[model samples]
Target: MTWQLRRAHEADLEAIMHLETITFVHDAWSPTMMARDLGDPACFYLVAFPPDEPSAVEGYAGLLAPRGAVEGDIQTIAVAESARGRGLGRTLMQALINEARKRGARLIFLEVRADNPGAQRLYERLGFIEVGVRRGYYQPDNVDAIVMRLDIPELESMLVETS
Candidate 1:
């Protein structure tokens, strides 16, 4: 399957929100919060469109990397259920990692729900290491969060090997 990734624009808000809501369900961010993050200069947001449906978004991801910062954070990433198992999540994650590298980040951090072994495996495949854990980080469901960190240099090498 072919797809394209590009920086998100204001016009894609509704589609992004739709995917985000469905993908994250009870833990989804509010439209207001998403809008704020999308507009923030320190944030890099991207959306992926499948080849057959160029105008339709299949996934989206975001990163927080301040200018000249040594560290960055994966703010969010999600692929539509229909789009899963097609490498959409990996593509979105790679995009965020590249953006973080470009912004001078030496390391990137992210938290995945403890129950999400699929996501954890993906991150591990991309060279992320388990750093710590946040107990009951995900509210309502009371899911623990597994903190992961990826060193930029290691990530770069991993990307090269995969490519």
Candidate 2:
């Protein structure tokens, strides 16, 4: 399947919010919250859409440039239920990594729910290492979050290998 990844626009916020809801039922952003992220200049948002259905956002990923030694951070990444298992999430992540690299990012970091094995597998496949753990990171459910870090050089090598 051919997928297109591009910078997200204001009009895509609603679709992204809906996709986020379906992808992250336990922690999804509302339309207003999504809008705020899109409005932030430091944040980079990208969406993957089906070639046949340009208006449909199949997956989305976001990154934020950081200060000091931290290069960038992955804010969120989600693929619609219908689009899962199609490699769209990986494609979205690769695109985000590419963008971050172009913006002079040396490292990328993210947090994943400890119980999300599927997501953990994906990140691991892309060379992200478990750096630390945040106990009780998620409120209410009190789920732990695993902190993952990926060095840009290693990621670039992995990207080339995958490509």
Candidate 3:
């Protein structure tokens, strides 16, 4: 399925929150925090929906890269169970990376659950290297987070050379 991507607005809060609770399961961010991030000037959030059902949000991602910032962080990303393996995750991630670059970020960082190898693999394919581990970073689950870093210019250069 092709997903329609758009800058998340106030109206998307509920649909996004529903996916957040379902996807994150034991470690979803609070609705208050998500709402605040959506409104934050330094953060860029995107919501994806199928062309047929514009009101339903099947995936979403957020980036914390203020304009002129030297570094950025991928705050979070998720896709609905039915939407998995449909390239939506990759699309959302690439979009976030592009946004970070446009905002002047030279480096991008993200943290993935130690248990989620699929997401880790995706990041690795994007040229993100594991930097460190945050012990017990996830609340209520005690899941460690694998910290990863991607040098934006470096990855872009490599891609250009390979292409």
Candidate 3 per-residue C-alpha lDDT over 74-135 given as tens digits, one digit per residue, 9 for 90 to 100: 99999999999889999999999999998999999999999999999999988899999999
lDDT of 2 by residue, 1-163 (tens): 7788888888898888888887777777778878888888778899888787768888889988743334899999998888888898888888877777877788999999998999999999988999999999966678999999988874445554443
In candidate 1, clashing pairs total 0
lDDT of all predictions, in order shown?
A: 0.90, 0.85, 0.93
Clashes of each: 0, 0, 0
Candidate 3 weakest ten by summed lDDT: 154-163
* Model 1, span 1-163: residue lDDT tens: 7689888988888999999888888798988999999999999999899766757998999999997999999999988888888898898898888889889999999999999999999999988999999999988889999999999874446554443
Q: Give all TM-scores, in the order shown.
A: 0.92, 0.89, 0.94
Report residue 111 deviation for candidate 1 (angstroms): 0.6
Residue 150 displacement in candidate 3 (angstroms): 0.7
TM-score of candidate 2 on Cα atoms, chains taken together: 0.89
Ranking by TM-score: 3, 1, 2
